[model samples]
Target: MTPGARVAAAIEVLDDIEARRRPAADALKDWGLSHRFAGSKDRSAIGTLVFDALRRRASSAFIMGVETPRAIMLGAMRQVRGMSVDEIAALCTGQAHAPSTLTEAESERLASADLAGAPVHVAGDFPEWLEPSFIAVFGEAAVAEASALAARAPLDLRVNTLKGTRDKALASLAHLQPQPTPLSPLGLRLPLTSDGRGPALAAEPAYVKGLVEIQDEASQLAALLAAAKPGEQALDLCAGAGGKTLALAALMQNKGQIYATDSDGRRLMPIYARLERAGARNVQVRPQRRGGEGLSDLEGRCDLVLVDAPCTGTGAWRRNPDAKWRVRPGALDQRIADQDQALVEAARFVKPRGRILYVTCSVLREENEDRLAAFLAAHPEFKSLPARDMAEQAELPGLVAFASRFGEGLRLTPLTSETDGFFIAMLVRS
Candidate 1:
């Protein structure tokens, strides 16, 4: 396919994404089905354009002075994709299904486009109203932090210790030359560039045999914070698909009991099957009866309660570029409320002396440090744990030095770890 056809395909994908409120991956998949003629290279080029457009949507629109998909793609090609005016114009010639020819005005803007001022800041491609919250959390590093958010994230995978060690998994995936992630001992980092190939791990023997699971480094660290011990009672409250629960089981060496439950049984079902494949004998799936004792039976019995609460998911925007744009202001408000409620309810399951690990893939204060303050205030029995010290407790020699050199807690920006922007706070019941 010609460059023009790739641009045209990107425009179509973007339109479907914006109109149907679907994700870029889903839109691309739908487009691939409809246009079976598009080969691997064409799909790769088109996917790149769509992701680049989404990564800097606000700035692309501002630079082109047009909010339509075509204008955004054109501006992205110029400013982000680094396509020259002549190249873009030549590609957009009078070809079938090609992008419309650039007008003189569009050409001028393309030739001399400046995304300075607020647009540059907003170019993180997040909702406009979210700026203040991000500012509050990130402060002086907001723009750099936001810019990191706009960039592509690397592919990270956790070496499922249940099946194999990190070194063993790395050797098995020798062709990919996956490297040990700097932050988490259990994680491996792959290429950051898309390179037009689909997820490269699907065919690997380790991934197929459940020796490795795809998870971000920060998430691996957060799950490590739970510090599940053998013969202890652990509850993965809000265990959506049980990534952490699976991690915790490995920590416990499958000796302790993990009562994984969710308000919605549909999500927990997948975890049950995953636990089976993982050979996690200590895990028991308890489906709740529509808010009726979802965890009432385990009240005050858990040694570790992991509240992987839902939030705005601001930290993970780099991986899911479309999410940052699709999330509305009202949605954020609802998310915050949900986090508060989940914190209050999940806290009940913690044993008097046990700890609750509250985590969110968010860079917002209202969901992280602020929520901890509120929870501490409401429940005097619970006290905030020094997260920096806890992350240090992981005792992975490298992370200890990293935390010592850099102050910890509340927020982990993209710039800080090149991982997701995550916030984790721990609380212990008195």
Candidate 2:
């Protein structure tokens, strides 16, 4: 399809999403199913435009002074794609499948598009309700932080040390020109195309052969911060799909026993195949069974417990921009409840002097610092560790500069770390 046709389709998809309040993926999939004539590339291009529109929806609407899907597409062309008015006009010639030619108002708006005096929420392209939480966490830098989160995220792959080194993986994917991530020793990053598409990793030998795994750089840093020692006993309390569990196995040189389990058995199903493909050893799966005693045998014997807790996922907005719009205050409350429960469960397995590495892909204080503070208050036997000391022990001393001012932990945001938003803290059982 032509780029103009793709833009038209993306506008329709966005309209469906807004009207039905459905997920963008669901709307996009349904659109693809109904319009079978669109090839894979056409569908991908349309999806990219739809996502980019969503990413800058607030600012786009503000600039165009309209919230309609057509205005969104035109404004996004100016703001996201950085197209000149003439450049955009070429695509909207009102011929064939192209979007109708922009009206005089739209052309003028595109030419004079500026967010000079817009509200922080509009300027940041995030929900207005989230502004207070962002301000609470970021102070005067809230707009900058949220704007960063509203941008596109690059693809990041973590080299599976159990199967290959970072250099080996880099060489294997050389055609993609992947670069080693600045923060993560094991991460290789591939920039997306201008239209926001990543390489098809399923066809890549490096990915298929288990030399690399798709993971955000911040997540890789979380696993590295755990710093699991060889021959230690560890438990991955919420090890959904075993991303970090496999990393722990490699870090332990496949010498330590790592028990991976999640509250939902369905989430744990993928880990088995991933473990086999990655050639991971010394890791056991404990899928929660219906009404069954769960991980009872793991009580009070773990040297390390990793809680990759659930949250609102605000930190991952760069990859899932629609999520930031759909999220509500109730979701944050529920996520905080879940995070608190996960910490309580993690504490049950840590032996004396053992540590619990609490991690979450959330920038909200209610999910990170507040939850940890409550956990520390309730569990007197556990104490928060200084971020500096933890970083030094993990051999990632550079992270101390990003230590949390709200409490004990390392805070990584797109603005601060150029990675996904992640909060990682360690609590030691005294």
Candidate 3:
């Protein structure tokens, strides 16, 4: 497909996403099925345009003074995709499958596309309601931080120490030239250019054998914050899909027991298989029928409790850029409520003097610092631990101030950590 056709396809997909109430990925899949004649390259080109537009949609629409799919696509081509009017015009020539020529209005808009940076309306790709929260959390660096969220993230893989060491796994994947992530010992940073294909690590023998798992370096760091040791009882209270649970199992060397439970049983099924593949024998999947009754025996019995609570997922926008467009301030508040419930419920299982790790894939204050403060207030017996001091205790290097806030939890942002945005707080039971 010609470049103009790709842009046209993206516009169509965006329109469906805006009106049909379908997800971006689903819309793209439907588009692909309907247009099977479009080759892989064409599909990829179209996908790139669609995602780029989604990443900067708010700003693109504001700059173009038009919210129609066509106007947004044209503005994105010039502002976000960095295309010139001439280049786009050539693609829209009278060729089969090519888009029609740019109208005079579009041409004029393209001519004035050179905004100094981002206009106030398009300052950040996030919703207008979140501008204050984002600015509060990120301060003067909010734009740069939000831009990082819009930027494409590298595929990160954590070598399962239970199956293989990072060095050995790195050696096996020499074809990819994966490099060590500065903070996490087991992490390998893959290239950022995705080639429109998902991360190829799944095809590697290491991945197939459960020697590696696709996890952000910051996530791995959050799991490490648990500091689970041999013969210790650890619990991943909100172990969705068991990514952190698996990491914890590897950290514990599959020893002792990890009571992996979530409010939803369906989310735990995949973890059972992954545990088997990783040869992890220590994870016990406990499906709770009710919110508070499940894991009654675990009350005050766990040495370490990890509440990997759900949140707005602001930190993960780099990977799922569409989330930035969908998330609103009210949604963020709902997430905070969810986190509070999950944290309160999970804290019940902490043994006397046991530690609980509260983690979120968000940089928002409510989800990070505010939650910790509320938890500490609710449970006066618990005290905050300095995240930097705790990280040092784990013998991890490459310390930064992002993780030094709140006197209890560590906050990891893309600007400082070069990884997904994550917040982790360790609380000890008095």
Candidate 4:
């Protein structure tokens, strides 16, 4: 399909997404099923355009002074694709399968797509309700941080030490020109295509053989800060799919025992296959039970407890742009409640002097520092650990600069860390 036709298709998908208030992926899939003639490349291109439009949805509407999908698409061409007014006009020639010819008003709006007078959320391409939350964490840099979150993200992979070394995995995936990550020694980064699409990694031998696993650099750093030792006993209280459980297994060299479970059993199903593929021998899967009765035998017996608590996923907007808009005010309240409940579970398994690695894939202060503060206040037996010392001990001294100003933890954002937004803090049982 021609570029103009692809843009039209993307606008259609975006319309379905907004009308139904559903996920973009679902809308795109349904569109593809109905339009069977569109090839894989065409579908991919359309999906990329849809996501690009979403990334700049707020600013795009502000510039064009319209909220229609077409306006968003046209405005995105200027903001995201850097297309000139003449260039955009050429694509909308009213040709077969192409968008209608641009109106004089659209041409003028496209020519001067200035965002100087736009509101904070409009300029940042995020939900307006989140502005206060972002400011509380980022202060003067909140807008810049939000803008960065709206941009594309690079594909990151963690070298599975249980299967091979980083150097060997790098050599195997060299066809992609992977680069070593700046902070985590176990991480390798791969650039996405021009339209923010990653390669089909499942087809690669390195990924198939479990030499590498898809994980963001921020997550790698969080797992590293856990400092799980060889002879220690650890519990991954919220191990959804066991990403960190696998990381902890590698750190412990499959020597110590790591109990992996989640509040939902469905989320734990993938971990069995992942653990088998990664050759991780230390992790033991435990399905969650009704109430708070799961893992009762291990209470107060763990040397370390890792709680990868759930959040609004603001840090991952570059990968899931549609989610940023779909997030609501009530969702934050629910997530905070969930976080507090997870802390309660983590406290049960952590023995005296043992540490809990509290993690969230969110840059929101309420989910990170504020939650930790509340937990420590309620349970005086646990004291928050120093973020700088943990970084230095983890051999990632560079991360000390990213320590959270509001709490004893480190915060990583797309603008600051070139990684997904994540906040991790250590709390030791006294």
List clashing residue pairs in candidate 3.
Answer: none
lDDT score of residue 388 within candidate 3: 67
For model 3, residues 45-137, the per-residue Cα lDDT tens digits are: 788888888877877777677888877777777766578889878877657666778888778778775545764336667777777778787
Give me the overall lDDT of model 2. Answer: 0.91
lDDT of 1 by residue, 1-430 (tens): 8878888989989999989998889999989999999998788888988988898788888888879898888887776658899988997886787888889998999998776765425655667788787677667777788889887787888888789899999898877868898878899987645342336676788887888888889899888877678899998888889888888988888897998888777887778667776777889888778665656778989998889888888888887788888888888789889888989888878888898888899887777777777777889998776645676566643444323112235456678777898876678888
Encode model 4's per-residue lDDT on 1-430: one tens digit a residue: 8988988899899999999999999999999999999999999999989999999999999999999999999999898889999999988977869999999999999987689888788889999999998888877788799999999889999999989999999899999999999989999999888877888998999999899999999999999999999979999998998899999999999997999989889999999999998999988899988975769899999999999999999989998999998999999999999999999878988998999999999989889999999999899999988987889878888899998889799989988889999999999998
Candidate 1, 234: how far from true, in Å? 0.9
Q: Which portions of model 2 show Cα errors greater than 4 Å?
A: 290-292
Taking all chains together, the TM-score of candidate 1 against the true structure is 0.92
How many clashes show up per model? 0, 0, 0, 0
Residue 226 shift from truth in candidate 2, angstroms = 0.4
Candidate 1: count of backbone clashes, pairs at least 3 residues apart or interchain: 0
Residue pairs of candidate 4 with colliding backbone atoms = none
Model 4: lDDT of residue 25:
94
The local distance difference test score of each candidate is: 0.80, 0.91, 0.81, 0.92
Better of 1 and 2 by lDDT: 2
